[model samples]
Target: MFTIGLTDHLEGPPDRPSGEIFGEVADLVQLADRLGVRYAWFSEHHAHAHQGHLPTPLLLALHLAGQTQRIRLGTAIICLNLHHPLDVAEQVAVADVLTTGRMAVGFGSGSTPEESALFGSVVADDRERQTRFSEALRVIRSAWSGDWSGNVPHAFSVPPHRTLPVPAADLPGRCWVAVNSLGSARIAGDLGFNILFSHLRTPEQYRDYCAAYRAAGGEGLVAANRPVFVGPDDATAFARAEPALRTLWRRFRQEGKIPAETTEPANPEDLCGHPINFIVGGPETVARKLCELHEQSPFDVANVEVRWAGLSHERVCDSLRRLMEDVVPRIANAKSLTGRMPR
Candidate 1:
């Protein structure tokens, strides 16, 4: 089965009250759930108004869980290095219980130096933070299974009592790591978790990640989180969406150089050879783009990002309906499963 989900960043002006965003998100999620979208993934970040307003995604997800049934709710990632892992374990466990086994989590070493500094010296550096994140997985799983030994890091003491909302047996297939490299993909696969990739990376990068993941015996499918905009036609769609895409370009424009050909774009129209990843088109074109993406990367799911990229509420809703009634049926027939991993 293939899965399609909606992911939003709640990116808006900081002055926008949290309640307004929450209500909008509830509506969006309800629409997605009713339309048979398999999962609703939310991102977690703190100290950044532009990236997302919701610092506590699990809380919002829990609220969403109350409003809908059957759709899987997830944190695309909760930065593990910044917070005590046990605190996260508690939150996820509660979310799991409330959602009745529908809670999926993605963990990451903190991403930026600025975000890292918010946590003081606990994170150390990228390598050290990654190490801590690696240890955190073990600690969290140990808490899940009611096992007290082996994986707990020495920095923290184990809880004497069994954690409530003990994880379901199939959690290995539910949790994920947001991967950007072959190495990270292999690590996630070796550790027995699903994987997430972003629109910024090329399909070739996805190919490398998937190959290494499969080499390491990964069972769960690789999923892509992409920004998508749809309209009545390609021109209208691109014209309406380019401004937001440009903003995204500037947002992701960072100090990094990797593959020589894929350097950051000089202008908004420059897609860095990844137009399909941005997903601007009519229904037919969008459907075709998804197929093309699957051809190269074989991703079983696409956690499509809307709203945050500045599409109007009306347009976002209309596009979502199009994705549901038009785009999805052409792509896959997957329904919301209780906890089954997409094949």
Candidate 2:
């Protein structure tokens, strides 16, 4: 069976206090730890009230590390282009130490032009952004390896400098690259970093990107992220999650994240079949959909998005519990016994 992990955006309504949102995230993570989930990741965003309010996911990870014992905690992604690689490297190193080597690092270029521009790193095109990302990653790797004294060849270069507090051993193996295109996938492969495929893409696209990564000699882990919600039954899950899905899709469409021509699904079954949608249903259905997803695009890890689009803390906790206690065990048992899904 594949590794099962949970992802949270830490998003809440504007009416609520940010403190309360953070508290709820902590509680959910603690509960997840108790439920024996393998990993938990938090997303990073800056000045986006409607999106995840968390500006520094690494900071949040440090906080969560103090509370949870078994579950690995990490940043879903840190916008590498927005900050100096030295600072980022130091922060990651300290967090790794504090978490006792249970910290994973995911890096990417900033998603939107607005957020990039806010940090004075304008995304004129993908090429420029990629250059910045590669350069920063090179430096971060160098620092973590304790060979920081060297001139890295890039527009952003460092000259024989060192960053304090080297990361825990084998940090590179724990590093991840958030892939949005074939180019990024190849880069991740070249750097020997894990590749995380976006939930926004279709299975075909995911397969294509994975092919590119493997072709580039990427020997690291492959992870797939998707929106997943579970409940006692299909109707209950659909009713609770559909509105949030609608709101999330509407916002994504407005922001041009998804193609305008793509139509939204009308029901739970349609969602499971849609090219760019999520998995939402009862335990059996959720388990089956997860198996289908693995068959469609094989991955070593499943990063399940359990909280988004202003889903309530209670709703998220119930879904997480069902996913961990009900859905995951069935998948595990089926895989162990027959090497295939039951349904």
Candidate 3:
């Protein structure tokens, strides 16, 4: 059956204590666990003007581990090419142990050049980035399995013992790769990792990518992230979302990062006009659209990014609660129009 989850985005600056946000997020995860949401994925970003916070998702996961019991915690997409593979392995291994084996590591060749520069990453060509990422994944998986034969020294090794924690036998799984372009999707398919397509393309594109992955013998969960906000009234939801949505688009346009042919709004208020840009509606509307998308694709998880630019934290949380209460149960329990939900 399909499950629902949230992708955490801790906005603002890194100097600000994440603990402030963590309190709220902890509450959200607790609610999600009670609501039967399967995963809570946190993203890693850096060196952005708007407080490019959350430098370490693994740390956040560790903190959440103390607060949550059943819901899986993960790095939505940890730019694996940035750090030494051994370091990544050690950190994730500890998180897995802390959470009692409830961890999913999602990796990607990050999109923004600014972030790459900040991390002192090589900024290699896409092919090379993919190659390095694949190699790192191998190293990380080997380290986690405690069966490494390579001469690579453990970065945090003790005199006679390695410091890394060994994950329990029931560890949820290894890393998932976030695929935006078709090339990455194909690589993810061939390599057999979980896939996360975070609203980077249309539903049709996602379906095609999923088909390719399955055809290539890839397995494990396939998930997507979509921006969704549900409220008691559609007008209130849209009104509340206007400012943040505008700011997000403005920043993207000023940076020349807007997708091809996607025009910048003359005013931030008009940002919602961009079709399929964001999902704003009440329960039934949101549920129908989610079910339709699932019917058309093979998504085992649907992660809704409920937090956006203009909406207040309270509003975002309320929207998510409503979604969990109204939308998720309907979609999770109902059979897809085609047949049973994708497992």
How accurate locally, in lDDT, is each candidate?
A: 0.74, 0.80, 0.72
By TM-score, who's the top model here?
A: 2
The full ranking of all candidates by lDDT, starting with the best, is: 2, 1, 3
For candidate 1, the 10 contiguous residues with the lowest summed lDDT are: 332-341
lDDT of 2 by residue, 13-90 (tens): 666688888998899989989998777888888776446678888988889989999888887788887788888998
Alpha-carbon deviation at 194 in model 2, angstroms: 0.6
Compose the digit string of candidate 1's lDDT tens values, residues 38-98: 8888887666634578888888888888889888888877877767777787788877877
lDDT of 3 by residue, 1-343 (tens): 5778778766754565767666767787787777777788888877643454677888887787777778778888787867877788788888887676788778877746777777676688878776676677666666776655554434323233344577764442456888876667777777668889876477888877777777877776788778888877667766777677777676666656576567666643366443335677778777877887777776778877776656777887788888989887777666654432433
Position 83, candidate 2: lDDT: 86
Give the range of the ten consecutive residues with the poorest summed lDDT in model 2. Answer: 334-343
Question: How big is the positional error of residue 259 in model 1, measured in Å on the Cα after superposition?
Answer: 14
Report the alpha-carbon TM-score of model 2 versus the true structure: 0.92
Indicate whether candidate 1 or candidate 2 has the larger TM-score: 2
Q: How far is candidate 2 from the true structure (C-alpha RMSD, Å)?
A: 3.2
Candidate 1: global Cα-lDDT?
0.74
- The alpha-carbon RMSD values of the candidates against the true structure, listed in the order shown, are 4.1, 3.2, 3.8
